[model samples]
Target: MADEKIKKVSIICSKGSLEGVYPALIMANGARMEGIEANLFFTFFGLDAVTKKKVKKIKVATVGNPAMGIPTLIGAIPGMSAMATWMMNKKMDKLDIPPIDEFIEMINAAGGKLYACKASVDMFGLEKDDFMDEVKKILTVGEFYALAAGGHIIFT
Candidate 1:
């Protein structure tokens, strides 16, 4: 088993925050770059990364984020989340990290597959039209598992 090579990667994104969503995207992108098959599955709040109206507006979660090192009171201030998001974007821009919308396009262009969770779409009352053009399909959990078969599964 230790000698087995990874042939594919199936990454699940289940959070909506900028910080929450990027890890799965980055991993999928990296897997493709390594010549491994890659699939990205967006579910629950993570669907925001693929939703047409919400993609560009995803923000970093300031409240209840322990990694941020800020007190809950401070993080809950009206403008704090926006400020943190802006700062993060600025830093990422300096480092040449693509925004979520552009990142999805890049992954698609590189032959990576993109999917939205069927249950999540229904729960959010979203239609197929609500997703970005890069999303290839809406899949039930079983369907996703089928696609994820023989691949490493990662949830972010």
Candidate 2:
């Protein structure tokens, strides 16, 4: 146990909302900060975080989000999601946290590998050009499993 070492980490980002996405980003960034190899795998709705157009303008999920303390019906009111997203962004800014796009760029520049789920990309009609250039490749589950072997796997 004393000689155990973490050589790599794979963080699976499965949800698209701001809250769903940040945990994976933060963890992958933290892993790299500690000199560990980190891989970020974006799938399904999570693909929003890697898409060039949506990456910088992601919204918080107000509707059906139990953490918000509002009724699901009320949460669906117009502008609720926008307001929540704004509030979260403001809080993060005050805390000196980078915006989503900038954070992704920072992680990429730090050598973190970013990947999109191939099936999702195809199902969603997303071309390679639709994603941020920082995404290294689109991978199927089997490929990801193989690549992530021998290290920790985190699902956020």
Candidate 3:
């Protein structure tokens, strides 16, 4: 019989905004569910997703997005960020989707790897202690490629 092939996937997140952040998280989580060996590498603005100080503060954008005009207008009225974030969380909950933090937890628990880009960490003036405890390592581009090579690489 032929040897079984292992599916590997690497997800690179480079944006900090709410919409930009979720896709990477969701995709990594999905990869784990499929029994794939998944790696999530956070870079640049995407570092916010794993920063302890910013992870819990993630908010939905009510403004700037063309599809969000009405919500943005309503959100600008008063206490909109909180409201929008709450609504977004509620919708996600209804869909049985965990929060980003919990999603990361699930992925890690499933044996997926989480990493932060060293260049981004330096650029953001972040130390190793500043990242989430789940981060398996801080990797340079070369090191990341070593892990990602021969696997599917996705950039979000």
Candidate 4:
């Protein structure tokens, strides 16, 4: 009998805002739940998702998102971003979903890997000190591909 193989998964998150950030986290966490070895690599705007200072402060954009509908209009109104963010957070809370920061921590605790893109770090003028401690390393695209090569690679 052959031993079962565990799947390896790689997720690249390139967008910065709330809508962009959550999908990556949710997918990565879901992969972990399925017993896969999952790696989430943050590049460009997605870097905010792993930054210690910025992770907890991620907010939803109410304006210009077609999916947000009514909230989009509300977001277009003055002072609506704050309200939208609050309501979004409240909805997540009601569903027992932890904040993105806490969800990231849970994923880490489950042995998922987190990485930052070296190129993006330099482009954004961010030092290693700017990210959270959970980030395993800052890697080049080639290095990221080495890990992603055989696995299912997803870009969010």
- Number of the top candidate by lDDT? 1
TM-score of each: 0.97, 0.95, 0.88, 0.89
Q: Which candidate has the highest TM-score of all? A: 1
Query: For model 4, what is the alpha-carbon lDDT of residue 38?
Result: 95
**lDDT tens per residue, model 3, 20-58:** 889998888888888888999999989988898888888
How do all the candidates rank in terms of lDDT, highest first? 1, 2, 4, 3
Could you give candidate 4's per-residue lDDT for residues 1-156 as a string of tens digits?
A: 258565888999998888788888888888898899899999998999889889977877777787777655566887677777888889888987778788878889988999999999999999888998888899999999998987889998
- At residue 113, candidate 2 shows an lDDT of 97
Clashing pairs in 2: none
lDDT, candidates in the order shown: 0.96, 0.93, 0.86, 0.87
Task: Output the better candidate (1/2) by lDDT.
Answer: 1
Q: What is the TM-score of candidate 2?
A: 0.95
Candidate 1 lDDT over residue span 1-156, tens digit each? 898879999999999999999999999999999899999999999999999999999999999999999999999999999999999999998988899999999999999999999999999999999999999999999999999999899999
lDDT winner between 2 and 4, please give it. 2
Model 1: C-alpha RMSD to truth?
0.8
